[model samples]
Target: MTTHIPAAAKIVADLKARFFPTPTYRQLQLEFDLLLEQRRANLRQGRQQEVRGLLVVAPSGAGKTTLVARVLRQHPSGLRMLTEGEERADIVSMVVPSPATPKGVGLDMLEALGYPLRRDRSAHIIWQLVKTQFAQRQVLFLHLDEAQDFSRHNNHNDRHAVISTLKSLTQSPQWPVGLILSGTPELLDLVNMDAQLARRLKPVEHRPLKTSVDGGMITAALRQYAAAADITLDDALCKPRFVHRLVHAADYCFGILVEMICEAIGEVLLAGEDILSTKSFVTCFSRRSGCPEGLNPFVVEDFLALDVRRLLQPEPGPGNQGRPR
Candidate 1:
């Protein structure tokens, strides 16, 4: 028996596959290319040397993960392959586990390298296995997403150990591995904890979107996404005022802006409508934020006054104001 998927789900999936090459993405691509070039140069010179890694710091919903995934996917030697029943991976990617410790992260890395631990092991043993697995798999680049969890420890020594382990990965004499550490802004503090580590990582940050600067891009995205879904956007919805409100509704994040556009398109498509309008966006925003019509930027007259960043948070308790969930 075959199962049928809804038209809305298909459209949403297609929309999610689309990528916008923003300035940040271009910068990330250039940095990745440079890192790969350094690796090649080292190989040509027949020298074992440490290579610089990337430190990508951004706020929540800034598309850091998407950007890194795209870069890795496009690289020539990024994917794993099976040759003669042997697995070889040039890139190994994993998310840093919460409450990240050196041991926990080391175990996660080993697992990502297809060498899951059979039993509990010391941090030292786990990392030694990780380094061995990295070399065995021919993994050159290690991408750790949500890496800010490494700083969650209250003990200064524990945090220092995490930083040291990351530094050591890029400086391993036998097989130096390039690192791609992406996380929230706090990750910067983690890197800065050690001066040597800070110097080894090339930092790339994702800045918040500016309404005046990004308005045109956001407008184009709306039209492009609607056209992709075979829906025409209403003229009023593309006006500058609405575009600004749309940016605000997305909390000035590029990824969130794209998501909102896709959501609005899905709403229209699922409703058997051919035209995309403010009502579609209003419905999508309401569904995502659970905000009342009066507080919704897409539905209100004074949208600028709405604290969109707080829209998804529950109401504040007495004296505890404007806290996020």
Candidate 2:
């Protein structure tokens, strides 16, 4: 039997698939292509060289992870089918485990490569296996998201060890793989602690959005998404004041802004509404943020005065910690 999917769900999924390639995404994609090409060139020439890596630094909601994933998915040589049941990916993507020790990250990489450890192993041994697996899989890039966790360690030696492991991965003579380290801006301090590592990494930053600069783009995105949802946006919803409030509501993060637009569109679609209005956004904000109409940026007169960022924070209660609303 075929299960029926809700129209709202289908529309939301379609909306998400429409990627808005911001200038920052384009720049990062170009840099990634260049790095991959360089690696390919060196391999073809049989030259033994250390591979350089990218350090992507952005705020929590800037969509760094999504941007990187899209780039990997679009690359021509990013994936390969080795056999009927075996596949090899050019990039092995994983999140850096909390505490961010060498052993933790090494084991995480091994698991992502589909080779989980079967027995207890030392940090040294685990990393050796990780390198071996990476080479065996013919992986070209190792992407570690949330890499800022590396700096959570207060011990000087511990932090240095993590940095050293990353350095060793790129410099491994037998299988030098490029690295993609993406995290918040705090990751810069972690990388800079070791001068050699800092020099070897290319830094790419995703800046927050500004109403004056990004208003047109945001408006276009809203219209595009609304049309995809078969809803017509109200004229007043695209006004400068409403646009500014929308930006404020999203905390000036591009990813969050796109999500807010989609959320508003989803609300309209689900509500059986043909015309999207500011009230739709007001309802969306109230539902997601658990804020009353008075405090919501979409409903408030002076949106800039409201700390919309705080709306995403969880209330103090059982089963509510660390979860928005």
| lDDT against the true structure, each candidate | 0.82, 0.81
Model 1 over residues 108-165: C-alpha lDDT tens digits? Answer: 7676666789547898889888888777776778889998888865379889888888
TM-score of 1: 0.89
Query: Which segments of model 1 are wrong by more than 4 Å?
Result: 1-5, 76-86, 118-120, 311-325
Off by over 4 Å in 2: 1-5, 81-87, 312-325
Q: Model 2: how far is 249 from its true place, Å?
A: 0.8
TM-score of each: 0.89, 0.88
Worst 10 residues of 2 by lDDT: 78-87
With a 3 Å backbone cut-off (N, CA, C), the pairs that clash in candidate 1 are none
The C-alpha local distance difference test score for the whole of candidate 2 amounts to: 0.81
Return the top candidate by TM-score.
Answer: 1
Query: Which pairs in model 2 have colliding backbones?
Result: none
